[model samples]
Target: MLAQRAQLPDGRWHFQHGPMDIVIGAHGSPASVDAAHAAAWQRFTGILDELVQELVALRRPVQGDCPVLGPIARRMWQACQPFQRSFITPMAAVAGAVAQELVACYERSGVTRAWINNGGDIALHLEPSQSVRIGLYADIARLGLDEIRDGILTDGQFDVSSVLPVRGVATSGWRGRSFSLGIADSVTVLARTASEADAAATVIANAVDLDDERILRRPACELKDDTDLGYLLVTVDVPPLEPDRVQQALRAGLKRAQTLRAAGLIWSAALVCQNQIVTTGDPATKKLENRRAHQQLGSVFA
Candidate 1:
């Protein structure tokens, strides 16, 4: 089927083509908003086909010269390059790269603030003095349609301001659309670009792990024959663990996030598993808001 789009009741636009389902919103003059939406749609129409043409290289582990020619594909590769020391592929950042591309259309004059949410991966544009409040959902499996339809019953919330140097947000977990080696319920990251956040979230989520007899895992290829992870084992089921074990896993993930933050690959991150949470920054200092019932989407490939 061809790409399709519809306007949401709240004035946001939803664009869907194959595996891509994006929600775009902008606050600006009517003329600018309309033009940006049009431009974004025009750009979105051909992205899937472009990625399809380079699927083989996109699925390969990051190493050596870039293998994809498409702009978005190259962005994905560059985003994952910092983690080339690990086994990351360009696919890890695909959703965020796509969102970033569309969000660019809203960066022109008159658009004070705009956001493109590709599943849970997001790209943002904020002019001077503008900001946006983002809700967080600690667990994707518990995200219901009602919560998404109404206001998300956010577990926590944070504001991203124009001065913050943040423009991207992404989440990943074992329970998400993509395979994860760790048992985290969710790992959310903020970065200077959506592609970086997506890649970092994936890496951090994969680090939130510990040896546990109750956890079940299977080879990535067993679940999806064409998965980029190949024979790597991925978490399938995680049983309730002792409190100490949970803390151990969260600490491991926290360390990984801190390393990325120090490297400037990520601004901050929050990791959650089995109801416990860990963050790279102090919540009070960061002014992050804690609330009940807010929901967020799981990370997915573009």
Candidate 2:
């Protein structure tokens, strides 16, 4: 299928083809910004087709001697390679890889700042002294419920001048578009690259599990025919749990996030399960402690 592009009312560029949908915003000289958009569109046009060419390999578990011809597919493969011993497939990094690729296109055009948001996985380009604020959704599915009606949902504001290592952000949960193996309401991760954040978010979200019978799971393939997880059990529903149980699940995921952070696979992570939340990373980076509404974004540094 051919890729389609449109300019949103608010001035962002939207590109979509197949399952990949991206929204991009850039700031710089008008000439550079326009060039970046053109480049992004050029790079995005054939990406879905290239990925489809290697769909079978991308879906397979990473192992010795697997070959893929597409650059983005290779990026996906490399991103998931660190977790090869696990059940991960290159597909786990698809969204982030796409975001990263598009952001790279923008960077080459000399944009001072840009962000490519592929679904909820984001790749950011921040020139020195420029920064952006990001909205953190504690639990997207529960955003509008009475419990969160107070509108106290906190938004994370990052100053690129202070925390330069982070350029990618991604979130995962059972309620998200993708199937998850754990009960985390949301698991957001930051990394040097969007691909890493995407892979780590999936892994951390999967680690946020407990043996509670109230959680519902089903074979992933049964829910989606082309799911990379195949027959692996994926969380389908999570019923209300005691506060203590929520903490237990969040702690489990926290341990995994800490390990990944120490290993340099991730910069930081915010994990939420029910009403409980845990964060691991550099303390200097801003964090959202409590949030009640759906995610909202605002600029922290102009």
Compose the digit string of candidate 2's lDDT tens values, residues 114-219: 9999988989998877777776655565456564556535445444432478888888888788888998878888899999989999999999989988789999
CA lDDT scores, all candidates in order: 0.87, 0.81
**Would you give me the overall lDDT of model 1?**
0.87
> Which has the greatest TM-score?
1
Model 1 clashing-pair count: 5
lDDT of 1 by residue, 20-55 (tens): 999998998999999999999999999999999999
Q: State residue 264's C-alpha deviation in candidate 1, in Å.
A: 1.0
TM-score of each: 0.94, 0.90
